[model samples]
Target: MNRIPYANAVGAIMYTMTCTRPDVAYALGVTSRYQADPGEEHWKVVKTILKYLRRTKDQFLIYGDSDLKIEGYTDASFASDKDDSKSISGYVFTLNGGAVSSKSSKQATVADSVTEAEYIAASEAAKEAVWMKKFISELSVVPSIEESVPLLCDNTGAIAQAKEARSHQKSKHGLRRYHLIRALLNVETSEFKRLMERKMQQIHSLKHLVSKSLHETLDLGNINSIPNTDDYLWTHGAISDETLSLERTVCNDSTYMRLTVRGRRSQGCDYVFSRVSDEIGADVEHDDLLLPKCLSSSSAQFRPLGLHGKIHAAIARRANIGDPCLPERIFTYLNRPDVQKALHANTTHLPYLWHSCSGPLQYQQDNLDLNIIPLVLDILKEGIPILLFSGDQDSLIPLTQTRTIANILAKDAKLLTMDKYGPWYDGKQVGGWSQSFGEERDGKNVTSLTYATVRGAAHEVPFSSPSQALTLFLSFLKGSALPRPHA
Candidate 1:
């Protein structure tokens, strides 16, 4: 009777057979042998199998794009079954090649020696190999099987027996039966030679062909054939509409109009210039007037401000127009108490500020800062390459922290330090460092960290050096190598 539970178990066995559990093929086959006969023990064993599947559910075989080369393995456990006194035979076959076929089952007959049992397994595997060769040939588009498929047997004796036909005695009945493989091998030698020649031809042909498909058979035409004109129209049309709406909104907004009027009024004001001059004059006098009598005791009772005033007045007369109103606005903005408070508030939230102040709340916040280490680790596990770049002059996240993070992420990663070059140059030598990690181990993961000190650059490196900033940003997006600044 075919039960739903039995059907589910069979479905699971087929799923595993298709995926990475070629090792379990023999076990599934053995258990399925007892499938027709109902038993409580069999159900218990199936449940255990399901539990094993659950534990290894995430693991899967990774098939890379490469030439299909037939490889195989054969193994047998000595007297594994207590009831039959027979060894379990198992073999796996791979092609391009990943494990494409496998089987595991108790031997049909009991073997006297471990060597005998392994020879039997090898024979079984060879039979499958013959069938596989025929199946591959039948496919219309399959690549030619030009090379001698390697049959890997861990037992040295089995390998010797397979290679040496004279080693088997005529009295050895099981060994005699399996000697058919040696006969088949003799017949297939010419075919194997032809396969080798075909492989070389394929390799040479692939070298000149740039259009060869790469990685899991990507639908390149499906993606590339999508008209670029459609994308351009969709993106540019939306952007144009948004731009028009933004302009209309800005022109109609009362606040924007008021700001524009205020900006013009301030720029046109002669009184603003006069006020700045008066303020500068007052500042000079106040400093001179506040000077301690003891420090000025040795000098004459001459007013320094009065002398400076004459010099400034001469300069003002020469110019005829007072200082710009922009300077007065800048001073007014800087002196505003609300602006000063906001600046202080923003600065206080910085990690360095927290460290200096020893603020518990800020320290906790810094501890919980979004470190990219976990994300990098996850990406590496999924076999995705990651690149990290940082500037030495970056006070926010220093080069030291970046290096520490990279080292913690993966040791196999390639780390590179590059000198700043190209547009990032400021007439002086400046460059950045980079670190990378992955299977390619190529310079692709190489990240360049560059730093520049403007003749008088402060914390905001980009703001101080816009040209260098633009060069760095362009290099990052385009994956272009930065030109090195000469020392």
Candidate 2:
């Protein structure tokens, strides 16, 4: 038995059991118990199960003809386990006349009677029913889902005892607190209507002024220039334009850096500089776009460039550069000499970078020390849903910084924790980790505030992790908390 690779064989069976064959669930559950130390008898049983799966490999679940009504059935076998006399609880939920969800597992406690065992199974189904009800509501296709979903069971006494909530000597089970974490939603573009809101909406952003006082301290403890090493450029694919601006603005460009990337679609290299470009390989033509009204004066009138990650207080976190040439190509494409001359043809300045002519925007040194925590608290008082998501590898604002800020905001707002820290999903794979804080009333979790960390994403989350970003945004827009992994 030790030589037969018992655990590996059982683990292989689990994938088939979870995805396609609920029929194998009970048998797999039974065999899985002996995976730790399977005897020769258990190895034979595992082989039999694998053989059975091989025979039924061609069988598939059929759907599409039946109505969309969700029907649930639950059953239990009392004292099914001979080792400990524990009851086995099982439930299956059907939609479109096919099994959409199913579970077969041992009960936490042993039930004394058949009715008690059946009731325990019903409770598990009840939780799933609530979850399905909410999920269907999110779909918005079914008009009659507001009504309570009906659960089918064979035992009549268990149903009556379930309606009577008071605990009795024979029935000794308690309800668990918290929302059901399992919600299966398709995040694909084809099923857009099934998961997301179709209505168009307008958003208004409140702009706050930055004070001239700079109080945000720069943490230059571990930051240093990689003069002749692979620590910076190689470890993290390459430095991004956003991080370049972040280095220049926050760290004052002490870590001198330059990146040269060639676009796959282009024949030439795309140039990027961490500081002001000195006009190197890029082709340039003389233009009069920057000639000031007072030509004798040297007071600069042109702004450098726009970078969203140049915020004063955000932390410097490291991440791999995923589309190295995209930003540089975009900048090059927008700042062509002919394009610049066509844009502003009359005046010019000593601007010899990609912009051969000076732009209308100039640099600003005003920094703010205002407390925006109170502003966030006021917004929370209005009870609008707020989702704050950060990339785990964001160089501008890291997940740790964002999480700490979120924790402080939740504490100040006097919100209760609705969803504890856990992994949320993009399809079956873990997309990221999330936690929600909200105001609860009437025994319902109304999640008005949530914070999520997108795994392996850069500062520009959508640009780096599009799939996970889409999932996070859709869940937030649907007023649903990030979907958690099934327990």
Candidate 3:
């Protein structure tokens, strides 16, 4: 065994185990048993496993924040070993939205029947599940685990054996002293259900459905694609010669008062205009001169008229002698109350509140964009629909652990019973259950929780089963009824 480069082989397998090979846990465990022995066949098997890993290298796991729901799978292979005849057991846990922990190992003792072996395996899986439930409660992340967390087992016989104490007499191997699953169940530690293998197929279908839905809902396929610029013409079209000219004029004015009609519109181009109207009123020939004397003596009282008197004098001095082009409407419009009000409103000093909270605004603008995690958590607490998914075939983190962690976090989560939609291959019906929280409580937000397994898929659900997975995911996200499988 040492001559076969066992360390290197084990390291490669370990890497896969940690990354994407939850399905290989049992295989890896069995292979490790032969690590101490010298055998060419072991090397061949290990090499084959290595080739499998190389083929699936791109299978990474993705964990996201989603609706808090707890569900998982527990599986074991009985009497698989030729040398020791020991069974291999595996379990996975998920939470908040990803796999957290999982294990695959050989059973400690030999068993007589497949059911007995599976019972032992489920017991071990249950212990881990209980520990995870307790751990999540301590973190204050999951609500509570007082209620049962559904653990799905494919072996109906094993499930029955585990649930009933009377069936143990049929076993040759005495039950392990630590087989406390029944006691735990009596006290409501966790719950176990016998799931048909066909249900796993449904879960697998649902997984694909959800993954497709996520892709469609989030449009992840095109997220990194180059954006089309064809429709951006309007945005670019805003830059025009007229706009440029106006911007230049505004920029050049110091006080901006030079833009007024009374000021010189252009340098050295004396196209000056003024209005002179002879109004019938009580007046003498020296009225203009006496007006200034009266205005000066009573400047405070006649301030409003004083400015008008000076304007009238300036107009009398500058009026073009015979320019018929000068329009009287210009002066009349300039003096209109609406025009004055418009100018006052356009002045920059008006209430404009954007500047008032500039400091806090900048701080939030820069930091708030990256801080959506807390917001997501807040929304989850409010009971909004959130779904986190992981492929069991995923390498980054095992979906087994993700399921375990989810159960721990959402221990009190209500369970939706599995219902048969229709039959798949061999007349086996396909269906699964979902649960929700915060939907009915007063002032609580609504969140629907679901977990679906993908059959024979490594990590990518949609890639494995596009049509079924897409349909399920769309229905879940849209809050529409999940499509029934064809009978």
Candidate 4:
């Protein structure tokens, strides 16, 4: 693979980018990643860049068309690379409508969100701004170079982060993403450093939450096939006049992996307050999870353990049932004084310190006759992205069932297959098998729906295989196509 003169061609391209052609910086940066172990695929990229250069050879950089003011533009493609989840940060400083300095490179650290990615990119650009400001001011070639440079950033969240202290205070998880004191705290600084931490940090689940309380509940609307929702059901027609309001828990903190969602029917805007453990669906149910057929056969054995106890016993064990030590660990954690203070076998209250709550011994389960594929299609039709993931090891919401649902949704949506089923990666190891489906928009295949399976993960993928889960999550958020196995 390394036999070709891949490095030489890359060097020439780099020279061309540095000398005059700033537009090629991004492509050059991506192609440079495979220089050490170049393959036929990577070699093709180099050739393509060469062809581009040949076609545009006549064009040259022209300056002095605009004012002497320097305009700095910074942008970032958040988690654009599939392999490492690193963002691509590019910045160009233009003087008199011609680029004087430009850089396209991978961020050293993984940004937690798009706003953070932009802030980090802006952070890097500030350094270049400072350097250019000084150089041009000393050269005295352009007026107002010593004044504050007109740095443009498209993301308002980043601007707020700089101006508002509360936003900066709330975002304390990924501080290394940018030097907050120097850049986000607002200023350009010394020479830029490329070593922004690129590795995906382990998700810190139990952070000191700033939401003031552990749990909050709101009144939500009807479920599918309910009295008011029947009008939108499959038999009625495929079209929905109203858009259902589905609100996912905000990723304000590190607890984004803990999915606590609230969905409402647009007809009545009614919802139920119930913290479902695992998935309440019958697909994940096992013999252990199911209650005894009658109280007579199980009454004596279950008389002491009330309904809530039995419910917790069955559901909690599913987390790590394979381990013999898990039961004792769960017992210890559950019996903690602090844990008991918050959870007292009855949930119908607020001001609690516990994370979430669940239903009583008996509850109203969803109707078996309802088919949610139509509802899913409605959401997809609204252009909202949907990601369906399953753990191969999960019994409850089995992988096969989720995969079938994903197929059904795709067929119903009439989406084209963007990438056929293939293995995606977390670092160098195989993380999972995934496939994407989407409709083309503006000459580009925009993946609106994805189905993936995390290898060796259980019902809760993140709990069992965090790294792979993180990989899947970042890909979905970035809207980047999953990397094929061979690549």
Assess each prediction's global lDDT (C-alpha) against the native: 0.46, 0.55, 0.46, 0.57
Between candidates 2 and 3, the TM-score winner: 3
| Each candidate's clash count | 13, 10, 32, 11
Measured against the true structure, the TM-scores of the candidates, in listed sequence, are 0.36, 0.34, 0.36, 0.36
Summarize candidate 4's per-residue lDDT along 419-476 as a digit string, tens digits. 8988888888887898889999999888989999887665556756667888888877
Q: Give the TM-score (vs. native) of candidate 2.
A: 0.34
- Candidate 3, run of 10 with poorest lDDT: 271-280
Candidate 4 TM-score to native: 0.36
C-alpha RMSD for every candidate: 28.2, 27.9, 31.1, 23.7
Write candidate 2's Cα lDDT for 70-125 as tens digits. Answer: 66667777897899999877777666455778876778887778987876777777
Local accuracy of candidate 3 as per-residue lDDT tens digits, 360-462: 4432322211323334445556666555444333322334434433343344344332332232221243423223333444763434544444332223445
Residues 1-487 of candidate 1 have per-residue lDDT tens digits of 3453765685687687666665445445546767667477777666656655554442333333344567666778788789989887877666644467767667887877788788777788888878877777677334645545666676666666666665444346645667666665666621111112222111112112222221111211121111121222223232244333332322212222232433422221233324323433333322111121111232333323233332222222111223212222343464465775777754443433211223443322222223344455566566543544443333223333344445545542343433322334433545343333333336344433222222222123354334555665666567555544446
TM-score of candidate 1 on Cα atoms, chains taken together: 0.36
Report the error of model 1 at residue 361, Å. Answer: 31
Predicted structure with the largest lDDT when compared to the true one: 4
